[model samples]
Target: MPKSRKRKATVPAAPPPPRRPRPRMEYRARSDEAWYGARVVVQDGWLRVMFENSTEDADEWYNPGADFASLGDVEALRARFRRECPPLDHARCGDVRPGDKLCLACDIHGDVEELKYYDAVLETVERAAHGVEQCACRFTVRWTEGPRSGCLDKVGIEVVCCVPKSPIQDPVLSEFLDDLTKRFAEDQGTATAASQQADPTPMSEEELCGVLLSLKRAPNSSTGKP
Candidate 1:
């Protein structure tokens, strides 16, 4: 018999390495800006929240303590933001609708809370545009699952000044803006008069002093306290 050709042993391909599970956190919540809003991030045995601001530069990040009291506080915290921050004018000025899922800017009316990391002004406003009833506008935040975190103490933070999201009037700021506009107009008028009919000399020291004193003494009728 002719030499039989030796059959070559076939080598099996090496088994692929096992895939590692991805470490990821899903953040979902109501926000005024794209990322600057109340959000909850769920991760390995932990739930993290940042509601003070919706931006990367938020005043604080609330790591809801790993307990019942902290978990219970979520609802109340959302309620407070809804009560204080003005809702974005989605119907008229913004892209959001009643059901559309997207973040809208908030109308922060007053100072932020120093200790609680919430808005200082808790009272809601009654918008005249709607007439009679208080503004239905509010910041809404919702999330699933219980909370867990390794943090020990609540964070104390100060947030940046909030710009209005729409034309909604803020009781504290509306009058102030009106006065600001008036002051600007007056200043422009003075400059125009000086350029057109008077000498180009800068304001004298005495005139500056008089203006400062007048501003200091000017009675503000807007705040009833004054």
Candidate 2:
């Protein structure tokens, strides 16, 4: 009888390690500065908040859902900046730029801004703020009727949140941009390789003539006739 070969013991491959969870972001507020969380407007129309003073009242109004007709025209809105707003370190940054919208929970002092002057490079990256006219993000509000609903009626609230430029920069967004750039490079490389493989290399003139001659009958070797 022939000897039988024994099979070697096989080890299973180990599974890949699990992915780590993404880091959570925490927005910081300056010692003197505080963010009034989203304030909701219950019934339609604006209600002037009654506080110790106009500055305190406007600060309360802008909290996460407070209603405002534009961020101004109210006495408290104008005075609050001078009264409630703390003096900043001017050495840190210049004036605000356009297109920058504020974040609710992030700090206003930690933000780093990207500035552009010339038109050529301006169109490449997105700008956060501009001049004194920064971007404002609006919150949708529906008017409701309370016991006093008949007093004012339906009016939408326009919320002006802080632009991150004056505060904290987002780390998650920076990472996403980096990932997008790498993906674009890989996709372009794949397309270039595919194009190269689709077209075959050309044959030499000598090769083409030899191939044609082989297919033709041997020039009448025995007969020596045309």
Candidate 3:
């Protein structure tokens, strides 16, 4: 009988390496001038955060310190996203209508008291008397974001300001404005050069004195009496 072929010993397949836990967004932080969603994680025995909007190939770490006071719960973070402002002509409090969007300063209570601005929608507007200034106006607005989202609060013109629509929002208008600005600058430069060329050069002290002396010695041209 042919010897049974030695059965090749089969090695068991190794188990796949354990997967890393996905980062959980637990907090929001502000860096520079903008707010970003963030997650806290520990590395090398130190706490660090990864910003969701980071512009980097690898995760960038940030130290949450005094500067992180801007950091807050997700609700507060959401509030930082301000709504677009109204048109330039409608930027004044008096120009805002019941349906217009505006900004209101809100107090954030914590270890440190802070005033934060949030987007709000005007529900009602109480304008001051004809003679009174716009600052005297009052408004009822519903918070669009933040811990007070959807809550209505009465605010004064002092605490509320119109959010002006950015020129960049309209590409055509923005381009036109840019062209106008360039032309204005060029015209100003040309005007300055022309004025400089038209202006006469200053005379030296000696030349000025000599001219004055000659004028005094010469007969007065305007009056025959001289």
Candidate 4:
């Protein structure tokens, strides 16, 4: 018999290198003035970023590290933005009317001139000229708190921010409670009707009191006393 051909040992193929995790869509970077929203993209084997508020051309690419100092994810950036820049009360501003409560910025002069916000009630709103923008409308407000309390002054809409509306105005919760109350009353009425049908004669007050007293004096299992 012919000698068996020597078998060549086979080498296992190497596993592919682990892939890098893709970057999240939401990112923020700080410029000299404020935090700007940014998104990352991979182009020609290089990671690049673009800012939402960038004044530069849209096609311009920025280095992640060299361009931005403190880079943060979406949540962190939002928190920072909230802390640094309080949002304008657009809801209240939209439907502002007389007697509406508002918080407005006040310029206070002491050792240092400081801009502060104080609670106030709107007294009147003066719309801008028909040709002009509504944002130019002036509001007359009476201060309700702080050193300027009870004072009335005309201020631009920009100085005013919306007061948080009370949660009691939520119609969903009110409707739910109303439905629940009606259902509970109906159940109680049904139970009472069933009970009355079972025994048509009503119990006298004295008999009802006697029954209650007997129940009160009945055995107490835990204490072994009536």
Q: Rank the models by TM-score, top first.
A: 3, 4, 2, 1
Clashing pairs in 3: 85-163
Candidate 2 residue-wise lDDT, 62-96, digit = tens = 22133333223233332222112121122222332
Answer with 2 or 3, whichever has the higher lDDT.
3
Point out where model 1 deviates above 4 Å. Answer: 1-101, 104-166, 198-226
TM-score of each: 0.21, 0.22, 0.35, 0.33
lDDT of 1 by residue, 35-149 (tens): 2223334444344444432233433333334332432344433332222233334233222222232222222333222111122221222222333332343423221111211
Tens digit of per-residue lDDT, candidate 4, span 3-97? 11111125545633423232222222332222223344455433344544333343234333343333232223223221122224433354777
> Can you tell me which runs of candidate 4 are displaced by over 4 Å?
1-94, 110-113, 129-134, 167-226
Tens-digit lDDT string for candidate 3 (53-111): 33333233433232233224222433333334322222355666788877566655541
The weakest ten consecutive residues by lDDT in model 1 span 152-161
Candidate 3, residue 107: Cα displacement in angstroms equals: 1.2
State each model's C-alpha RMSD to the native: 28.0, 27.5, 24.0, 24.9
- lDDT of all predictions, in order shown? 0.32, 0.29, 0.50, 0.50
Which scores higher on TM-score, 1 or 4? 4
Identify the candidate with maximal TM-score. 3
Ranking by lDDT: 4, 3, 1, 2
